[model samples]
Target: MITTNIPKLRQFYKIKAILFLSLIISTSSCAQLLQIVEQTPLSDLKLSQLDISNGLKGALDKGVEKQVTKLTAIDGFLQNELVKIVLPEELQIIDTKLRQIGLSSLADEGIKVLNRAAEDAVKEATPIFTDAIKNLTFSDAKNILMGNNTAATTYLESSTSTALYSKFNPVIQNSFEKVGATKVWSNIISKYNKIPFVKKVNPNLTDYTTRKTMDGVFKMIAVEELSIRTTLNSRSTPILKKVFALQDNR
Candidate 1:
């Protein structure tokens, strides 16, 4: 019933083809966002060096704040399998011995107080860690942002471990005393020592627990950093979202 104009129909199809091509280019641009960043000259990067540095620092600070607070919570370290402080190798046999002697409850208390001391000591970490992160150099930031998922965490650990040891050691020692960990462990060791033909042992629990607590803290920070790098939901801040997006498509 209708006669189609071939010329007008050809024009309409040409317009449609042009629009489809534009759409394809736009989609390609989105898909190549990260590739473009990688290929972009360093001087032409959209984000400034300061922006990159500050963004990395901000991410680390958030991770430390969140995970450290969780570490300080009740049952945080004790209940968490990842960072749970268990008796050292020499003491594992002692735990078995205590259970064999039907004093499992006492053994339980000893272990509980150790984790409690770590939890209590972790409250001191935020201030020290904050200072360290705030002082990140521009070089540090660029390397970390471009490095592996846990690169920021690795930087924090390497930069702050010795200082954190000094900071955490005395606190853990005081925490052990405050929470009766020293007393409980003393009882445990005394009872174990009383067992005939057992080798005598005296361990520096302060050093041991401090090292373990720092390891746990770093471990948790690494987890948070990796989550932020790989999981969109973990990017809670604007900068975190934007900065981590570079690595997202990679």
Candidate 2:
């Protein structure tokens, strides 16, 4: 009589299950490998160090020309809500108190003058930014290109903030004087100080305005840098397209 061996039958089924699992795992792994291979094409593998460096420089130059130029123009900071200089924390209470007391016009003028000072001071930034961009090395280019969208702007800010602050502070101080912001703010603060039973404020306007002006400059550049990194059409030049393309793969 023919009889089935229970142990042999169990071992054969277990082996079949193991083989099926192995097949599934191998297929999934191959699919993942194929995806990785497709993401990084062979064409970009030959991109040279100099090409990447120049491409990053070109992108920054375009960003500076487009965005920083706007900051230097009349009403650039005042009109642009993105980078407009608002009152510091110490001054906001003064603004609110004045507006509540029917001194809204004065509050408005106080804010307007701060933005005007920023617009004037940002005019000095383009040269500093250009010098920084020109000095970018290959290592910086590789790291920045592979980094997040605003990486280039962050690099520029870190490398140039100290010099920029030194350059912008005096200019911002002078701009406050030139644009009559000093007088306007003085009047606002004097009136606010005179209000009954309110805490007095005598914040340093020069330091505040200088820092805000630099912040606006970097913010605008970041906007452009992000656009170039994310938006396909914003890469206006050939070098930008080629270098940033490598970043796209990552």
Candidate 3:
């Protein structure tokens, strides 16, 4: 009985082989499917790289918008303790003496003027920072994304420090004049010197504020960088999510 159906059995086996070959051909020839497989590693790398670059750029932009811009505003530095300019080391004694003699308001005004000078100086920061961001190479971008929490800040400092100093110094000098910081300090110091027992103190406040304001700007940038690198919630955009997701896996 089995021998009588041998030809039919042969036909069934042939059909099965045909189906298997067809499946292989379809799988191999499907462009979309094959493309997906080909992109597995490359797409991941590209996506991760892009996310990191965008995240860093976003953080810097936000810092400039939120923190730096405020510092450039009228009372930005005067109001914020974190970046407020204080009397220089040599002038601290004069400040203390002024405050002690019922001249607290005068002393406070002196302090405010220093901060105001800083605020005025910060108006020049965006261009320097933008140049730094624009110059970021692919290697720098990768390092910033995958390196430590302050990687982007470090890159900024390295890339922009010399240029920033060159840029900030003049602006700070001008700001000192524009905000009347020079006159305010002169008044405060004059009052202090007029006190019977006190020696005169005149310090280069413009230089001090310039350096301090630069430090403040960098400090704010570092804060934003750390937030994005350490806090999951800081990855606000889709690219940030995907890039940081891969980072989490690693």
Q: Which structure among the candidates has the greatest TM-score? A: 2
161: Cα error in model 1, Å: 0.8
How many clashes in candidate 3? Answer: 0
Ten-residue stretch with the least lDDT total in model 1: 36-45
Error of 1 at 150 (Å): 1.4
**Candidate order, lDDT descending:** 2, 1, 3
Across 12-111, the per-residue lDDT of candidate 1 in tens digits comes to 9999999998997888876587656654644454666677777888899889888878999999899999999998997788889989989999989988
Lowest lDDT block of 10, candidate 3 = 41-50
Ranking by TM-score: 2, 1, 3
For 1-250, candidate 3 gives per-residue lDDT tens digits of: 3356889989999999999989987877777676566447537566644555766677666656666777777878777777777876777898789878889998888788778777776777788889778766655766666677777788888877788788788887887778777788788878888999777666777667778888888887787767766788877777766665655655
Relative to the true structure, how large is the alpha-carbon lDDT of every model?
Answer: 0.85, 0.87, 0.75
lDDT of 1 at 106: 90
- Regions more than 4 Å wrong, model 1: 1-45
TM-score winner between candidates 2 and 3: 2
TM-score of model 3 (CA atoms):
0.75
